[model samples]
Target: MKGTASACGSATVINAIATGEGGAFAIDLRVKSTVSLTGDPSEISGKVGNTEEDPELIEICVEKVLERRGVRDQYGAQIETNTELPIAVGLSSSSAAANATVLATYAALGGEIEPRDAIEIGIESAFNAGTTVTGAFDDAAASYLGGGVVTDNESREILKKIDIDPEWRVLIYLPPGRSYTTEVDVERIEFLGDLVEVARESALEGNVFGAQTVNGLIYSSVLGYDSQPALDALSAGAESSGLTGTGPAIVAVSKEKNVEKIINVWNSKEGRVLKTRPSREGARIENG
Candidate 1:
């Protein structure tokens, strides 16, 4: 049996460190994973087409879903994933991969699961693979449900979800630095307790731009990122811009008319600029 799933990367508005409240948006870059029965019943082998990423997470994802379903594998598993998003950066590449892997596993097993159950299974895989800190519920949900989502990560509950117009452009400046979720020190981020709380409130109130901007600046300052790229994006007429996760990559929000302005500012920087639109379609099965 074989199954395929397509999921997208997400830019973090909140890191889920200090306050459980967090937000994220689905981007155009997609990660597609296929899971199939393989040669050995007890073995699960996987490959990530992205060279910088480890495929063990994909294996873990399949195992996690199987374990959750209390199923003893009668056949081996093979999983292969291809992604357009940069790996190990602030963008939620891990979450996207996990989401796709989990869904693909379910399909290969001839089973169906609710979207919430699928997300939980994916988060479980993330924990088993050591790829996350807070389980990245916001990121995973945004990738799975598409569009923007505000959530309580600890509770695994979504506080709000909104669809942004596809016409809005998302400009990403990917720098050389790598900020994996596993490397973050939760205590250091928790120090900015009150600021994060205020930011979370802003997100809950539906002020996505303000909330994301505040969260980004706070995280960038604490994580030792330059934060200049984000400021530059704003100077170039971005409606909202800031560090996406912990550091390294900056995500900017702009209308189509202002895309070139944002790209121009990023072009002067050290990293490459990737332009995409926000996605409203969530993760789903792809015909194989």
Candidate 2:
């Protein structure tokens, strides 16, 4: 049996480590996963097309899905993932991959599961694989459901779903290296809980741009990243700008009129820049 699925990536509005509550918006970057089950129950493998492969995450996703369906010992699977989203850049690549893989595995098994259940399975797999800190429910929800989401990561509950202006553009500035979530100092981030809560409240109140800027600034300072790129983007007329995930990748949200100006400024920086729009569509199984 074989199945295929796709999920978009998301940018952070509020990192959850500080407050256990977080917000994120879906972006156009995507990850696709294909699963093929083999008769040999002992042979399981996974490969990533663009970046370094995390076989443990992929394996756990398949295993979790199979176990959920009570068919873990029935078959082994081969998983292949291809992504436009960059890994370890705080773009929700791991969440997207896990979601797509879980969905694909379910499709291959000819079964259906609640969307929330599927997302939880992916979250569990991520935590087990050490790819996440607070389970990243906000990122997973945004990537799975699309648009924007405010979530209680610890409780794995989505507090709200938001719609972003579709006309706005998202600009990402990827620096030279990647920062892994597992490597982050959780205690230091949590020290900013009081401030992050203020940003989280702003997001809940629909002031996403302001919240994103503030949250990004907080994480950037605590994570030891340069905040000038975000400041530069804001100076270039971006609607909002700040660090997206943990570090190293800055995101700038802007109107079409300000996009070119922001891009021009970001181009002068050290790393490359990518332009995309907020995704309103959720993860789905693709027809073969």
Q: Number of the top candidate by lDDT?
A: 2
Against the hidden true structure, what lDDT does model 2 obtain?
0.91
**Which clashing pairs does model 1 show?**
41-76
Prediction 1 TM-score vs. true: 0.96
Tell me how many clashing residue pairs each candidate has.
1, 0
Report the number of the highest-TM-score candidate: 2
Error of 1 at 4 (Å): 1.0
Query: Please, what are the lDDT tens digits per residue for candidate 2 over residues 143-190?
Result: 988999999998888887889977899999998999999899898888
Off by over 4 Å in 2: none
Cα error, candidate 2, residue 94 (Å):
0.3
| Displacement of the residue 69 alpha carbon in candidate 1, Å | 4.3
| TM-score, candidate number 2 | 0.98
Tens-place lDDT digits, model 1, residues 84-121: 88887788888899889889988888888888988888
